[model samples]
Target: MLGPDGIKDIAKMDPREGAALLEAHIENFDGEAAMTMWLQTKPKILYKGGARSRFAAAFHPRENKFEVEVLFSKAPTDFHPTCNQIFYFGEELELALKYAWWAENRVPAEAACVLQVALPASKMSEGVYVDDAKRWERLVWHSRRVDSHGQPLEAAPDTVVSLLNERILVGPICGMSPHVVQGLPRGGWQRLTKIRLSNNQNATQVVFMNPRTFVERCEEILWVLSSVSWRGNSSQDLLVMHGLRVQPLNVGQIAAS
Candidate 1:
């Protein structure tokens, strides 16, 4: 996995160079192969305890939609195939894959697997709906480390951004109550997804803004991963700079299993 030094190296380059480099890393690494290796070789260190175990997203051009499914050990699997979140995408599969890699590299290994597999059995139509207008770019996410009881463990809100901007990169292990919201939208409509990461060494809060186009979104996400100070406790943090490949199975195969 890529490390903080790798990210810092990319940050020194211009955006175009940085993006190209990031793409190279993503395309070259095989995320599925890596997972197989870990599952086979290092069985005990699979994922952060209570952290997400599997995540997968797919874009169906025919449907013009994107679906993201997250599976946590805590969530009940008795339902058989789990549900996911759905949103519309204006771009093609290539862009979807790029964003997928970026997201996969940002978190720990277990959560990162979401990038490698396709949840065919996971029904898309059954997933929760996400407003396309309220895309990931539209909101800023905020996370803070907290004890099991859920309290801010470090850094004030005013200091968080600067701490991120300046590379302070300090926060709780496995974020506490992480929430997102759009800047312009006020009151109730502004809020987005909120979940807790079970580890420490991460930012308490995060936010997002949508770009005008798909390429712009990719560039912005790459830039953030390359430059933003990440405080993940695991080595997977900021590893997007390296080659982490994913072999997403087809919908039919996933569904059959």
Candidate 2:
């Protein structure tokens, strides 16, 4: 019965050994239920797409079995999204540090291009939005259990409607590349100059600079993003950046502590 304590023990073990244990008790294991229990344990370091030194588990519907895999890198060809839904819980700064490390090591030069295209200047742009909608439709079609004659066992009209009405949060459009001033270190700042809207052509460029290391910059970006209040339509109410610059006051003490 893989209880909460067992899940905690598995979290502490080597991924391979933990997976072996899970496979040994496969009949009694339940992936979704176990994932809920695992999350309740609140592990500080987890990798989403099976990075090394983390535990990832998933349920295979076709096989009707729970499978556990050691967290490790795969060739881009071998990656599967459903089987890689791992999560980590930690301080925001710690997560940002991991992102910075991954950005330095794993993120390729082409990633910036991909990010730029994925998040276009126009909200209803014809690139990522279109691709994502098609993907969602395909997923809905595949999820239905149908007979050989192509009739669904269950009704799917509501699911299709829900997909159509989904509100995607395409974040603010800003300069994709960070800029470094003359005297600053290699780590640069991101400027959120203007917000692009249909009728708002005369919007002024508001520059916000942070001359911190890559990790600190990543942390700041995460903080800003999470702090945004989506309740109001006004820019000031939406993204309240009142005291964002106050981080510099204690920047030197952060590393030491």
Question: Which residue runs does candidate 2 get wrong by more than 4 Å?
Answer: 1-11, 14-20, 27-46, 49-58, 61-257
Model 2 lDDT per residue over 34-111, tens place? 343234433222112112122212223234322222212221101111212211121222222233334334644111
lDDT of 1 by residue, 1-257 (tens): 22233323321344444344444545444445434433333211011111123232223323322222222222111111111211122112222233344545555523331121111111122222222323211212322223344432333345333322321111112211233221323333233333322232221211111111111122112211222212453323223422211123323333443
Report, for every candidate in turn, its global Cα lDDT versus the true structure: 0.26, 0.25
Could you say which candidate leads in lDDT? 1
Give all TM-scores, in the order shown: 0.22, 0.15
User: Which candidate should be chosen as best, given TM-score against the real structure?
Assistant: 1
lDDT computed for candidate 1: 0.26
